[model samples]
Target: MMRKIENALAVALIAIVAVLPLFLKFMQGVCRVQVPGADIAVLHFVFLFASVAGLVTWREDRHLSLASLSSVFGEKIRRPIESVKTGGASCILSALFINAFCQLVNPAQFDARFWGMSVRFFFASLPLCYFGIIAMISCKKGNLIASLIGMVFGLFISMGPFTGILYYLFGMENVPSLYAINDAWLSFSKIALLPIIVIFSSLAFFGMPLFLVLGGIAYVLFSAGGGYVDVIPLETYRILTDRNIAAIPLFTIAGYILSQSSAGSRYVAVFKSLIGPFRGGTVIAAVIVSTFFSTFTGVSGITILALGPLLAVVLTGSGYSKDRAESLVTASGAIGLLFPPSAAIIMYATVNYFSIDVFDLFKGAIIPGCIMALSMMATGVVLDKRGERPKFSGKEARDAVLHCIPELLMPAFISVLYFKGVFDLFEAAAFAVIYAFCLSVFVRRDFTLKKSARVVASSVPVSGGVLFILGAASGISYFMLDANVPAILSGFITQYVKNPYVFLILMNLVLLVVGCLMDMFSAILIVSPLLLPLAESFGVSAVRAAVIFLMNLSIGFLTPPVGMDLFISSYTFDKPLSRVVKGILPFLIVQFAVLMLVTYVPFFTEAFL
Candidate 1:
């Protein structure tokens, strides 16, 4: 019953938020409420509600339990509540108090001092509160440490100098209604009350929807109340026409479709057959296959997921040690970062206000990619010196090549179309999709209309998730531009390093670090705007800068913690992350060395440009 209510509420809330503007306009026409910027108000409401709904859904789905009053209050004689009903009431009251306090505080003084301090306060307060709550709930809970870690994350989101930088960039005047509360009471009300509403509302299916509706109302009220409001004029839409920008989704879709096709599997088979006979051949096969497929796919997750199993079979069959095989594939999985049609590259290009020929980028990446692959092969050889390398017969090789013919043609077809100007990026992508569909249905005889529809549906989520992030990043970029962040960053870099070469190297290192910590798409969107202009100031070719940025980000997938490729490989091989990292160190070093080469020698990328 609770779940059903939650579901209904969630749906209702989404609908309300989506239609808020139209409703508001109608209300204004019918009776003058004198609402200012109804569209902006509607947007603010939608953003907040969406955020709350997403948070609630995530929490519920994860079964993230909260702590008990006793744990949080340290076994006080006066227990707050035994049931969720009482607990929720207490939360509402507490949030109300916080909100009142925030509202009563002076906006000007808070802006002067607490504005900057709010980020730290949020980090310090929210996590501690959550931890205390969680600790009070269940004694057997093991997530206390995880919650504490999340506090650190909260700090990154809230208190960091970077946060201030971002806030300033996004246009301090244009902060959303919910986020723009100036009075301490209002601020507290928004922060505390909003989260509580989300949690309680999520308790029932309808809760999320209700919360969204309330959030929309709050946005309307806040915006009408008039704190700070600035909306980009529609003229800014012209920036979308930049040729390179169009390549992003095209490349992304191409990569997605290729991964979905049998071509992905056949590519793996060919790599295995060719390299399986050599010493540490399976590892080599993994590296080769990953590298080759990455050219068209450009996604580390898809590449690793698709190729990991195939490589594993070849490696084990070729007499390589299991550890060596696992480590080799894991290391090779990083190739997706360097290949063309890469999300990283597309993202970097989009953010930097430029584009590179995907084919040209592929050519430039070959040397560096080869270096990483060879390094992986060397590591496998060293690790399994005694293992017998499998031998491939002529017949076996012939059959393997023949099996991969359909798959092999995909890259060639894409490259030819792109180079011949047969179609723009989107049109080329459409062609690729059509080609894949034909191959799957006619050649492979494996695809039904229903199956194809499912595949397309599955791909939508993947595409949507990425595009959503892009939109958010764009929003953040808008904010940053308003703040003059690019100018400030450029000034700082120029002051510190006058030499272009030194500056480029420094930028590479920074991007590498950022890539290791953040998702490639988000990182590109966030960092590229500030850094790209700086590169241009130093007379760096836009294409060269983009290539360097892509390479650095690609290397990031091999690093610890946030490395998506490492995570995929670890899961595929069922090996500890630490072991995989250790085994991949040699490959990492070689890749980094290649990155440095690309950074210093402009010719590596610029020759083609």
Candidate 2:
């Protein structure tokens, strides 16, 4: 039943993304559905909104707590105010679209400022609409009325009726500083910010989806700061629609295609032949294969979700316990982030608000990445000491090598094209898609045209979910930057911690905490900026700083309590979270050891650079 639902969802996402290249032409002014007041009517904006709405609804449960609005949140908020479904999102989206369209057609009174405000209001309401729509669509009649009442209250707040009355009472229209005129409102918003943060923070505490929580807090903070409401959707549209970032989804699809085919097994077979008669050949094979996918795909979860089961079976079949096998696979899952062309690394470079070259960072990652992979391999050898070495056959080795050639050569193919400037990252991604398609469909005969569609269908949602988080996260990032929050935090850190060693330790702890709270991609966006300044104060190179920061985030994915990879491992192996936690401890300890080495040994990152 779940598989059927997932298949249906994948098909829908593919259809939506398929519309992008065609509809994006409209975004560039080559095509548009002209409404009256608005000159730029981007159809792709509507498509993206619909895509985001669907992704949030499909991926998360539809529910909220009334008590979340009050001071009480822990257990009291457990009882959902109401549950929602897809229809709820559609209703709110319909409202947003209709209201936006109506404003574009004929904004009330036609004043230019009012027209702009109306448009800004439409875009600003997007994040809130995620909840507001759900509230309206709850099955209960009371929920419907409550949602409407909340909407009314929101509208009143937006208009500032109280501010207008206070201004009239004070006769402050002629004030030199405009801020002095609306003094009461500004003070109140600032004063109320603490509670406002607390209220929204609970939404995240209760698992209101990180993307929504990030965007929601940004919205609330921006509103309090008297910022342009349009920043919310504008940042959403900008970060998501970047041409370079398109490589993420393409590479993810390629990785998934290889995973779902014979490619993974072939990879393992080739590694087995090379390691011939080793005590832990199979464990090495699983780690190497996982590294290949995680490097290109950029999400450790993909490696586990696609390859963990097969690797688990191979390890257990080779006389390792099931728990041990699961633990090995789980720990090795996130090592891909240490490699070049890492989605996390690229995103860190792109969003860091600095001028760091992608290639330079790629150059710096090699040694540390190797250390991580080797640590896992050594751990595997030590943990399972029983020597049941497979007999090495030259014929079998030759056959395995022959079978793996086409896929194994992928990194070189991508590197020469990318490094030699024959193609950019997105073009390399395009080539990768084409290359993987041929390898699977023709050379390997692992998939035909019909079978390939199933591969694509399964892969599209991963891309959608990832891309959606990036889109929403940008708004959160902008809010922090605009508030000079990073500068303030950096100053605070530098003021207290002068030692680079102490700072690095604190940095690791902070990143680990952040990793447990959000996805690594989102973590890079929000946290990297605050910490990077200390790199200069502590006299570290940009490449080393980035590696230190990203590497910690990589390990954070393995960190317990809410590490994203732990959950992925649990779901993949059908193990309870606690068991996965217990299973991964020794591996986690080894990860920490390597992390300490990478932290102290400047040679590991700087040598290649």
Candidate 2 per-residue lDDT, tens place, 1-609, comes to 744564565555444343443344344446555334332222233334435443444444422211123234454443442222122223323323333222233323123332244434334334454444444344445455545554443433333322333344564444434344334434565778778667556656545545555655665566578834446655765675465565666677778888888998988888878773677777888889898889878889889988899888888887789999999998988898877678887788788637467778888888899888999988998887666667888888899998788887987898898889766666666677767778899988998888887777657556666766676678778887888887788788889988999988887888778867677777777777767766766887778888888878878888877787887888788878899999899989988898899888899888976
**Relative to the unseen true structure, what is the C-alpha lDDT of residue 603 in candidate 1, on a scale of 0 to 100?**
78
Enumerate residue pairs that collide in model 2.
Answer: none
Writing each residue's lDDT as its tens digit, candidate 1 over 42-62 gives 333333233233333333432
**Predictions in order: lDDT:** 0.53, 0.67
TM-score per model over all chains: 0.62, 0.79
TM-score (C-alpha, index-matched) for candidate 1 = 0.62
Candidate 2 regions exceeding 4 Å error are 1-77, 81-188
